[model samples]
Target: MTGHTAFGWRTFLLRWSGEWADSLPHDEARDPDDEAARRARWLGFPPASQERVTAMEERLGRRMPPSYRSFLLVTDGWRHAGGFVWLLAGTADARRHDNESELADMYEEDLDEDAGPEEWREAGIWRRGLQLDVRSDATYVLLDPEDVDEDGEWAVYTWASWRADAPKRYTDFGSFMEAMYREFHSLRAHRTGREPAFVNDTTRELDARVDEARRDALRGDWERALKTLDEAEEYGRPRARGLGDQIRRLLGRTHLVYFPDVVTDPRYAPELLPPLAAEHAAHSYRGDASLTFPLRGADDALVSQVFATLEQVRAGAYRYTAPGPFGEAVDRARELARWGDTDQAWRTLTDALPLWRPLGPDHLVPLGWVADPVLGPLLTVERGRELLSTPRGGHPGEAPAPTPGLDPPGLAWLVDPGPGGGRGPYRFVLVEGVEPEDLPARLGDEDAEGAALDAPRTLREARWHLPRGPRESSSYEDRPVMAVGRAGAGWSFAFDGDPAPFAPRRFVSPAASAAAGTRAVVVWSDLGARRGESFFHLSVARDGTREYAFTCTDGEIRRTGDIPRALDPDRFFAVPGAGAAAERPLLEAVAEHFGVRLPRHALLNGRLHTVTTRSWTRPPRDGETYLVWSMA
Candidate 1:
């Protein structure tokens, strides 16, 4: 009565029972009340009076466990799913069950194995037992009365009716009940396709915070809710991290934008550039920038046109010249249309229709091009009515050509091209499937002044610079530095600034670089901050393969498709003569790759500085060394 309130027990039972009922198919759940009653009838038997339970215990010559007694008082038996079994019996059923009789007979047959009380108890050979439940096939849940402890709690076991081995054991009825509850929940979730919210017993404090945050969210105090979730995350609660992401999305702080009609005509696609640029500005940096659209009748021209226009508009220049009367009219109409005089301009165009009427319908200019399948121009007489009567945002009818890869959002990067070269520090937009080209017109109609925009670089040309070591001195020292180059269709690396062949040591391999069509980066480093410099670079292929370029002391650059010694010292040092002083440069390079700072004293030591395979194979005994020098 004090530990678990009746309300809590009822709530749990009702919720789980309701979930079970909902999980049933429509045919089984036609009458909800009848279905619920049938399920409850199978799952819970009539509650047993305390006197009946006591009488059953007396007949069995053992006290029934308090937890089991309490469970019987609530519900005489359980018939829910329990691992490979069901139907746990009550006091009356347990006393007269056939399984109990069979268990007693088995105990009598194994009496010879029960030598003494202590040994029998230790071996779990009990004379008196209660058959709790029978599995679907050949298994039984049993409670051994002879194994009862000081608390009058009998040991529980799961017995395979056919197996000869000792049964799987549980400490008490409470533990058995816990296992049954977990199994029931798991089975319910699997069948229902709906997992109830998990309340962690160990994370009570964190759960309390989460509940408070939910309350805050309900009251529209999202900032406070987010703060609470952050605190929970700092405490290492993983659920808080997911909740935080959901809250950020709900607050519209995510960087992703939804513009499904972006890849339409090449002419009107430039309208997307401003909104995209604004989105980038809002996020500071574009993370996972994507442009999703329907794949049907998509044009590469739209992609190219958008990129070209963005470059030109950012640079304040128009490249394409209007050809013929129709082209000129389109150019003029667009200019006037953008300035909010679309109706008047359409009327003017209608007045001049006689001059361009001879150009034929195919050559007629398009006005206010919307996303549609038909690519011909609107008649001059219909232009005014369509412009003034069309609904807001225009209608997205169909595409002119089939554009693949647009259905799944295409990858794009808005990068700053750095300063100088007459180009302002505007972001250069590069879309993956779009060809680089010059724009026909400025991105927007706004007359901003600047130099002609440069063509945006392709994804392959977007080289990412690797991290460089800190500079300790201003002096120009002849130290080894790393460099990267393309080898065949893949990539290669070399150590520069060494002597003769050693300086330009290069390693090339087809397997070393990323697979064709995948994106990757070439990482190079000098591995020098103060002194004792070394050089190395590697290709981190798109498939996550790290190929190390090992430049030996003898000027031979060996390429190994394995992690270098510096990065994994234990594995590399496991081989004899592998960790020599001459390998220090490669080790230093690997160290630099992993951003490890070596001790200055260790670097200055001459004995430790130069290690070779010879030194490792033939070491000096005691403090003796043989050095043969010839006078030249």
Candidate 2:
């Protein structure tokens, strides 16, 4: 037998034995004479002679494939598992293992008399195959001698005597063995609750060394653990590379240095501590699958040192460019603060301005860092100042003043407006008591109730206060409100309740509207009614300069030329008969007056009647005396 054949047989023995040993139940005693053990012993016997292989071939009247023949030279017979114990027939058992005769007999006994010629050929599986394994269970490993290729290798198959169907086939014996071995290993691993590591005789010593290293690591003797792993590497350099690295990292935990409180301390000088600390910190953060050591587990003094280093680096005291350890330190400090040492966390952050500055205008600190009441107030104040100083575009002190003549009404009209801009959809609130006769005049009067004259107010002037509720609802209540105007043909209606009315909302050009001749504005009570819950008010100045304004209960208020296509009133109202015919006169009047198409449905749904008149002292009741208007 050749060296290659001997090696292959030996590898098979080691793998089979390893799987069996690993798979045995802990509570069950293993038998030394078990089938797996018996086969392993047989494989160690002298290689089969050429004459013996030839004699077995003659008895079967068919030659074994080259790969199988080579395997036979190493070990003539073997047994293993995959659902069933597979038995490879040897030269000594050739006469009894002659499966060709048995196959022919099975074909004759099971052939269907009514089957078509092609069907019969397919069903006569026994005629084309030879059973290699002897089993009472009726499932057999088969070899298809009739399907031999140019290489003289027969196809292998697995056949079940109980099922009268063609056997499942494989390309050759080598592939068949390989597939069986993989499945066997997987099955054994599952049963044993441990992964099966294949170790042949050649690498047995190296594997033993690895096992010793693992034991050492578990006991925390990292020095000895790594040394043992190095010995394994000497025997298997390339293959042991990953194992070597893993051991080193595991051993590295012993040397982990905590963040020192003082940078100037002799123990924490740049050359002595940073490099070693960085390496150990990285490993600690990564964590071992078996042993985990968190950074917060370090003493408070050490943690203080870590932050001190970070602060020094931030202040350009030490040019520590590596961000990994620094980031880890921040995360560790935050974690510690979350677990109750918030003051230390705050101090760490206050000194690490360089790290926080790069985090953007918000200088977003971790939520835990600011959750502490004592630390929260101080941090927020400082953070807010830092954010305000961040250069956005204009100088920090040069914020543009509010647009003139655009203030909202009383405190009720004021909203929180949130951080970015004014909140909520642009909406209109009809100012009652003003009539059509007040056209173009009352809108310009600074003293007129709800007029544009009283519109421009500062945030302080609004004096808006918040009410408590579910967070989202309460937050919305704080949005700042602003007044809006409609440029009508001869008059305009003041919409004082809109939240956002500037560019991106109403496109305010304070200078543009002022330069244009005074536009006629009507506080049309009935016109607001003819329009819907939310209506479009067209304000036309005496100079014929017209401006279009559409109010929505929610969403941004879009101006004349910049309205999105989806919001186009024509799309919703262009269809005929969409609104009551009685309102057509008022719709036509507003559309014709403004020189634009009118949204009739919008007029019909206007919330004008919902307004409470400024002159009325009490809420209106059914049949009570109240000011009423007629569009006619």
TM-scores of the models, in the given order?
Answer: 0.30, 0.29
- lDDT agreement with native, every candidate: 0.39, 0.40
Question: Total clashes, candidate 1?
Answer: 8
Task: Show where candidate 1 strays beyond 4 Å.
Answer: 1-15, 29-42, 81-83, 95-122, 125-127, 135-137, 146-150, 159-169, 192-612, 615-632
Give the number of the best model, judged by lDDT: 2
Give candidate 2 misplaced runs (Cα > 4 Å): 1-9, 25-32, 35-46, 94-122, 160-166, 192-632
Q: Write the per-residue lDDT of candidate 1 for residues 563-602, one digit (tens) a residue.
A: 5445543343334444232234434443344332221111
Q: What is the C-alpha RMSD of each candidate to the true structure, in Å?
A: 24.7, 21.5
